[model samples]
Target chain A: MTLNTWIDLVYLLAAIGFILALKGLSSPKHARNGNLLGAAAAAVAIGFTFAYPEVRAHTLNLVLTLVAMAIGAAIAVPAARMVKMTAMPQMVAIFNGVGGGAAALISIVVFLLEAPGKPAVYRIAEVLFGVLVGSVSFSGSAIAFAKLQELMTGRPITYPAQQAINAVVGVTIVALAVGTLVTGNVPLLVATAVLSLVLGVIFVLPIGGADVPVLISLLNSFTGLAVAASGFTLNNNLLIIAGTLVGASGILLTRMMSKAMGRSLANVLFSAFGSVVTAAGGADGSAESRPVKAGTPEDIGVLLAYARKVVIIPGYGLAVAQAQHTARELADLLMERGVEVFYAIHPVAGRMPGHMNVLLAEANVPYDELKEMDEANPEMSTADVALVIGANDTVNPAAKNTPGSPIYGMPIINADDAENIVFLKRSMRPGFAGIDNELLFDEKTTLLFGDAKDTLAKLVAAVKDA
Target chain B: MSTGILEFLTIFVLAALVGNEVIGRVPSILHTPLMSGSNAIHGIVLVGAILVMGSASGAMQVTLAFLAVLLATLNIVGGFVVTDRMLEMFKPKPVERAPKASDASGDDATGSPK
Candidate 1:
């Protein structure tokens, strides 16, 4: 077979490997295998590409490519191993963003190579689209990483005429894209990329922290589309297949995340939810005006030890405190005392869907005991104790009771229904969305104030004494 | 080239539909890992980066392609490594008394809760 034929076969095999990887990832039993399959596929693809006659002819390029891959591996391996479970979302965002950056760069280089000769308008359009989407994904993901890392405020950064400015920027980018296609202007292309980057920042800036996971998912899809565009510019079949798959899967995941929050994708992006509050009338005034029961670790320990059943609710605060293992220790102690223990996980808990589960799993928590909201709510009212561990908004009754509240209509765990409720909190601070939790003021609720890990340690000690 | 772009569009659309169905059945518990896994796949853009880098004729094009290769490699390496790390955590525990891997190490340093 000719060298091109060999390359084609390798690409075909690599595409199949990616498909198998995706299929395997959907199930826990096969997830590790899926990841390995992807890695092997990548190795094979890179190897075959290196052996291509054109690539082999470029000796300097070959050395640089190999060195780049090595450097990338050197940086990535340690970083991946060292990152805390809580920071996984941020890490994913950064890694995915770099891919988008690479795609944008690829578009620029390809455009420069083709533009001097008056390349076909369709080809120019494809290159422009790649640059546009790739730039947006890169910049948008940076904002997301900043938000997740708390390097910037998690609340939506909104100003006057925010959406209007974004709209104008959007129109300008489209115009520049068309101009580049018509005139084949490199400067216009560069301007389009820079403006698209600005557009990404603008696109994500007004979105509140609560909706960031959806945004991340959406940006991930954008990167996939960008990669696919690059694939078209190169006329590479494997890039088209793999990039499109990722793009599609990302869109689906974004939709699922939106559904889990009981919001539409448009609403999540444009809601400006954190900045606005609604005035609502209710029997329980506001969270600040109402009083709450306060308790110590000793009181909590006694309540938990004597309870017939306890359901634990975890949120981002738990992840922030790095307290998953401590929480699990407390639960194991309760279980040893013959008290039934199960975790009640809110769908939108932590930074993303299934985030709490991943953290808990890392702590060796049994998979069967971690229950979703729907499954856990029915058992909550019957449970003797509801342990709210560094979690607030998900348990708030306002989601169900007050239609005017920001998080109203969002599904939440019915933690308030338990006969007794105890909250481990740092203070009276609201959650990421900055909405005061109505659950804090419930008559049966007892606030145990402290850092999550420290408070959990205290509970474990107190439980032993009890 | 226009015909190539048209053919590319067809592939793009069909692959997207196929992708949607492929991931449609994933349960919520696996979503985080699944997202990370697919995120790694986008690293396939490294192929384009290499192609651009290898074929460029001038210094400017070479520099751009070099940056593309560097960044795409980062995406590929970091994406896959991080994804594998996460997926490793999701492995099903052996039914029989499986030895605690991470938690056991946590225990030796901090000891048990009691």
Candidate 2:
């Protein structure tokens, strides 16, 4: 049939690949294949897009596009191969930001091209909406990525009149958007674009680190919605379909992460973690003197040896070490030594939800022995030894005492309740959100500094010796 | 070479930024519970696809939207179902080995737990 019709068919197939790839990504086993399928579909769509007479005719822009593509591909490959697992959430945020920026850019380009002479109120409104959503997603996501990756403080930075300032910016964006629409002026449109971008950064500036996972999920959804809106503006079937898919999923994920943290979504976004300031626990003097004691693999193994009741309080540290398998082996050895061994897994442990448990299961730890905080909290009181792995915030007692702390209302592991707490840490550095861990200060706690893998291996040997 | 390159870049960059290896390094210690949690996010992808497709106004858009919705739905629902079933299977079965005063195997001192 016609080339146009053939291109449409190709796009439709690409959309299917998006669907399958997303679905396949649900399970780790199929994620690889699903991703490949989605990639192939995307490739076909791109090739077909070039076949369109209008797109092909722009040769200079076309070459630039190819060059840009090459640069992007080159960067992505090595980074994917080299980046650490801890950085995934941040990476996701950054990626979402780029998609949003692209969508916003696309919408603007289309509006300018199609309405070179003039446009109606509705077109202006749609264009403005596109710019606002896209800019917000892009800027907000970049900040979020920064927060998660520790490039910036995870805590909120606010002033007495920050909300008012945010409101002023918000109003400015809307006014500019509406003005650009009614006036049909290019410069005004440009102004609105800048305003929208600034507004996004300001919007997320006051957000604390604890809420980032939710934000990631939410931003992911934003990127999708932005794409869909752009698709609508351009009347593209695939963009609309794919964008909606991403947006809807992101919203759902935000809700789930909110629930996992035992907080509502609104509480996470609008409210500043203003309460963490008044908490009893602080990074203050008492916490400072209580040095974060570090030990070697040899020291921890020695403690595990012949201990009556050894408890493993794994946090994000355990997740990061990818040491669950080794930890499990250590436990098995302890168990063989006539030492009671159990895992105290906190509810909100690791970078994302269920991070610790996922890591442990990879090592094949028995599900039954893994204790929830409510159940495990009490166990820490009497255990001979408490192995505090890469976890920080969840185990912190500050969560309970400091209402001013960002994570004040969140529940934590009472690892401080244990007989002796051994912290398996990499360094004295603070956690993802940069909050000081007060649990490290307890007289009962001792720091064992090393990678989770190395420490667990040492423990395995020590337990064997006993 | 040109158009799809942007989209591909999006996916790979997304993977890298999110600690591509994090999920891959799922420690056995956290498996069942972690799966249960991430499963919920996966479900979101389904909802997203549905909403996108549902709002569309044409045959091709509709078809594409439908494909996304169906797949997302299956991904989430199937994941949760598998997790529940696995949880059930993993539920500490009645132990044939008689209990001793100190079953140091980290066995439930509190008895079979949910």
Candidate 3:
């Protein structure tokens, strides 16, 4: 067989490796190995591309490629390695953004190369699609990263005519894209690119922090589709397969994320839902003055020590205070006292879907001990104490009982079903949804005000004494 | 459309179907890891960047290709390494049978008081 044939076969093998890697990632037992396999597949593909006749002939380009890769690795390794677990969402955002940026650059360069000869109309269409979607994903992910990293406001930013403005921008981009297609004009393409970037930022600006995960998933899918468009431009099968896979999966994942919150994808995207906080806050101004029963750590610790069953519901505050370890310690102490202990995880808990699981896993909490919302809700009524640590919106009765509330119709943990409710919180501030949680003021609820980690430590000591 | 484009389109459609089927089964607990893993996979765009760079002419083309390679490299390298790190914590530790047994006994002792 010729060298070209052999190279194609190798690429095919690498493609199969990527498929298996994705399969392995979905399951708990094989996730790590699956990720490693994917890395190997990527390395093999990149290594073989070096042997392509054209690539090999260009010694200077090859040298530049190697140096660029080395520099990318230098920046990527340390950043990925040293990032705090709480910052994981934004880390993924930045990485995904860079990928989208890369896809746009590839499309633009290819368009420039083919422009001299006036490439086929279909090919130009592909290039334009890549430029549009890729640029949007790039800038959108950047905004997502900023919000999650606290570099900007995590709350949804809304203005009058927001939807109308976005629509105008969208229509202009389409017009510019058509202009590029008809004339094959580089400047028109550039204009399309810039407008698409602007659309991405405006598109993401009104999505609050709680909804950023779903937004990120959608952007991830956008990046995938952008890559697929580039694949069509380059006529690369491996890129086509990999990009299509990600695109399809990302869309499904985005749907799943929205479904988990009991909301539609469009509602999540366009509602500027959390912006109702200000209106809700103004209406419920007296909420802060409402009486809430306060308990000393010692008393609550004794209550926990003697309880037959205890359910822990952890939230973003738990992550923000770096309290997972302390929470685990508290669970262990309670378990030693013969209390049944398990963590009730909300689907949208801790800023992202499944985020609480990652944090708790990092703390060595057994997977079996971490229960999803549906599994934990039925058991809530039987629990003696529902210990809410640094969580608010997920367990809020407002999501269910108050139809007018910002977070209405969303599913929440039935924390009120427990015989007693003990909350560990820093203050009376509302959660990410920016709505009041009436559950906090329920008759059976007891508030223990303090930092999560410090309060968890205090609860552990109090339990030990009991 | 040419037969070549048609074939590529067929492949793309089939791949999308396969992706939806496989990814549909992943439980919510692994959603974060799944997203990150797929993020790494799309880094396959690096191949396109490399191929274009190989035949690039003039300073502008080279400059754009270089940036593409750099960004794609970051996507692949950072994406995979970070995913591995996230999944590393997911590796199940040997369930401490000893603790469970002791926990059972401790339950008995504490159960009488309640």
Among the numbered candidates, top DockQ falls to: 1
Give one digit per residue, the lDDT tens place, for model 3 in B1-112: 5999999999899989988887657778788888999999999899989988988888999999999999999999999988988898885773452366456435434432
- Native contact fraction, candidates in order: 0.75, 0.01, 0.76
- Candidate 3 residue lDDT tens string, A245-314: 8999899999998889999999788777445545345245678899999999999999999999999999
- Going through the candidates in the order shown, the clash numbers are 0, 43, 0
DockQ of each: 0.56, 0.04, 0.48
How well is each residue in B1-114 modelled by candidate 1, as lDDT tens digits? 557667778988899988888876777777778888888899999989988888887778877888888888888888888888777667477222224544533552363232
The C-alpha local distance difference test score for the whole of candidate 1 amounts to 0.84
| Cα-lDDT of candidate 2 | 0.61
Q: Chain B vs. true chain B: TM-score for each candidate? A: 0.77, 0.52, 0.81
Candidate 3 is graded, for docking, as acceptable
lDDT of 3 at B108: 34
Off by over 4 Å in 2: A27-33, A273-286, A290-303, A307-309, A318-329, A338-348, A354-384, A414-420, A426-430, A434-438, A449-458, B1-114
Interface RMSD value for candidate 1, one decimal? Answer: 2.6
User: TM-score of every model?
Assistant: 0.93, 0.73, 0.94
Worst 10 residues of 1 chain A by lDDT: A276-285
Query: Per-model TM-score of chain A alone?
Result: 0.94, 0.86, 0.95
Global fold similarity of model 2 (TM-score): 0.73
- Model 1 stretches astray by more than 4 angstroms: A273-291, B1-3, B94-114
Encode model 1's per-residue lDDT on A226-285: one tens digit a residue: 999899889999998999999998899888888888888887887673344342222133
